[model samples]
Target chain A: MIDIKNKIKEYLTKKDTKFNSIFEINKMSGGSSNEIWIIKYLDNNTENKIVFRRHYSRISEKENLYPPLSLSIESEVMAVAYKQKIPVPKIIYNVDKDHELGESFFMEFIDGITLGNKIVENRSVKLLKPNLASQCGEILGKIHSIPYQNIKDLNTSTGIDEMRKYKNIYQDYSLNIPVFNLSFKWLEKNIPPVTNKCLVHGDYRNGNIVVSSSIGIKSILDWELLHLGDRHEDLAWICVNSWRFGKIKLPVGGFGLRNDFYNAYEQSSKKKLNKESLKFWEILGTLKWGIMCLKMYDAYKSGYDRSVDRAAIGRRSSETEIDLLRLIDNEDRYE
Target chain B: MNNPPSKEELITSVIEFIENDIIDELVGQKRFHAHVAKNSLQIILRQLKLEEKNNRFEKNRLKEILKMDKDLNELNKILCQKIDYEEIDINNNDLIDHLFKTTMEKLSIDQPNYSAYLDEKTN
Candidate 1:
């Protein structure tokens, strides 16, 4: 095996940094898309430890394993989140050059457990049941509250014609999944004009948020999908049935009530989440998730990562379809 | 009354067998097997359960709105190729509700713990 310790030292030295002679590197678990290593540099003099993340591979090239562009997005989003005052790991260094560190950036590794699959398995998180939804809303509100002008260069804006943009993206992957096509058709037919555009975390849900067992939501992770669009997109995504895991009642990542989530968001943002607007976004959320599930399946079938999680995610397409149905049913009842 | 087993029934039987017999025996990363079995079953069931009805309903609704032939399968095939959802008319809310409800019903059965969750939500 290549001496990762010496390799890291050489790499860091080239970047003009000095740390402990010995580096302790341990691979962090989860994430089908990219390889995460928890590298702790023990300072011999100060006896202190500093951590940095290194990409396992490059984005343009295909790796036998690991996700593409995940590190690049992670590094970029971490920087953006830091600027927005959203709780996230601090970005210390970013190396995208293929010749340098092979992959991408490095950052101050935040200390918290990602509430991804563990949210469904961990019984301990039940204690935070009452406040979890509210906390999620607060964090999301903070994310959406980011100024649009600051990140204009990122091309995050959805533009004036939101419906047209959504239709194009939905159409791109609607072929294999017909139900989503129909849902998109429905959303198009009932185009609720966008009132305001704000910073939207395109993929905000349980899997991305990091929380301490005792401290609640420590930070929100994963901002690759961050863009400027209808603010309600994030809200609808959190409540989407597929994200609820197996716990359907607690719509907010299956941890808290929908009413509570909406109330909390309203309280935090001082903005009303119109039921009509929310319903439309919820349908869009279901369609988005359903298509995403199909994409994972397509990737796997086409000889991409054949991980168990990707397969499981593929099955969730049906769950999102079911949510789409329920949302339509609820809309019918109200109408 | 001797028709062959429907595709839906065959898929359901296969899923049941996997869930009951094959799942436990096929160790080592059984999660993927479970997922494949469940989704394969769902796709087949959805085709059997909703394909005909959705096609007919969507066709009639489209015909009413666009003043075209009520050939839904043809319309749907064309719709599938086209990427825009706004092209479809939404004059008849009732038809939209029916199509939406049917899709949801098909999906609800496929959820891992949907029944228990529904019971809790309803209560």
Candidate 2:
């Protein structure tokens, strides 16, 4: 047996924690980019269990494909979000040193189900439909309400220029996925004139959210792609059809109508929901997600962490492309 | 002559053996190795089913789009080369929809209910 127990114990001791024994250490499921472990410790009649996230080289030889800034960037965003009073797990410890558990961090293991495919099957949460969009809007409003000046560490500063930043990021990343080339060209030709900027949760959709049976949205997870950008980017992301489960009618995370979500946001944030701007953002969101899937697919093909989840994600590009087409078609009809 | 085990059967058998026999008996690196092996097997199985079809359909759709927009070879090449996040013409929604429909038709995939999506947007 490989003694990860000694390694974990040593690390805990160094962190100035008095622990007599390490009872159970098992890997947790879900996460394509990082390894997660649930570790339980016994210290003087007290038992404590905490989760650890460790970044590993997905591609054995091509260890540098995943940019160095990826993990630290995510950690920085999480810290900033935590400071802004965002509902997220309290980060207990962060270690960038490869020697200590190999690119890792320790955080309070949140006890809630990630809202993924299983969300549709879970009936208890299903009953909260009408309130779901409103709740989402309120949560998003709170996130967007964070003062831009306060979040100094967020690499990208908040401004109207964020649209240009998104365009650049998308252009660079989309080069790897051949299918999105046309979409990129189209986006270039139809770059909507930007008016407002806010803290955009780059991937604020169903998969990243956590829901509870007793409580509502426990926390928003996955800050790896967070950026300071247009507020409509987040709204459009939530309204994407791919996230709408099987019910296309219920646009906002497939839980409630779009107007309800918009009304809730307007009431909570006191900001107008610009319909034309939102339509443009929706197209962008679909293209972004679709391109992201293709990128993941390329990674899989290149033997970068051959996970079924990654492969499954790659297939979703088709759905996103479909959404993009529909959004574009709607725009044409109106014109 | 006996035929070689299909990719699906091979993956299924390996997963079953690991879950039933090796996983319970193993610990630490051995268990981790087994788990990784099982996951890799599943990934391979999915790829075997999906990759060929995905590529074939994408190529066919790209060709069709090129045919439709004759004299736009440069644009077609760019479009066929990659999928971009912010790379869509929101103003020319009809053209975008046509490309999407053509792609779907080529792939033999069912088109999403655009009207339903539109209704959601309008409401």
Tell me, by lDDT, which candidate is best.
Answer: 2
Candidate 2 backbone clash number: 16
Candidate 1 structure quality by residue, lDDT tens digits, A95-197: 6666445555555656666656577556667677547777888777777676556443443444224445545544554453445666766676666666677
Worst 10 residues of 2 chain A by lDDT: A59-68
Residue pairs of candidate 1 with colliding backbone atoms: A33-A67, A34-A67, A94-A105
Q: lDDT values of the candidates?
A: 0.62, 0.63
Q: What's the lDDT of the predicted structure labeled candidate 2?
A: 0.63
TM-score of each: 0.69, 0.68
Local lDDT at A219 for model 2: 83
- What C-alpha root-mean-square deviation, in Å, does candidate 2 show against the real structure? 7.2
* Tens-digit lDDT track of model 2 for A1-335: 33555777678768866644678888765354566788888767688777777754343523232233355556666776678777777787787676646667777767777756566556777677546677788878877776666544564433224445444554654344333455545555566656566777767887788888556677887665566767777888887877877667577776667777778878877788777678777777777666666666666777765755555556556666556655655562221
Give a tens-digit lDDT track for model 1, residues B1-123: 658786667787888887887777775457556756667667667666666775566567546645568365565555444424445443346546544544454444445356333542353
Index of the highest-DockQ prediction: 1
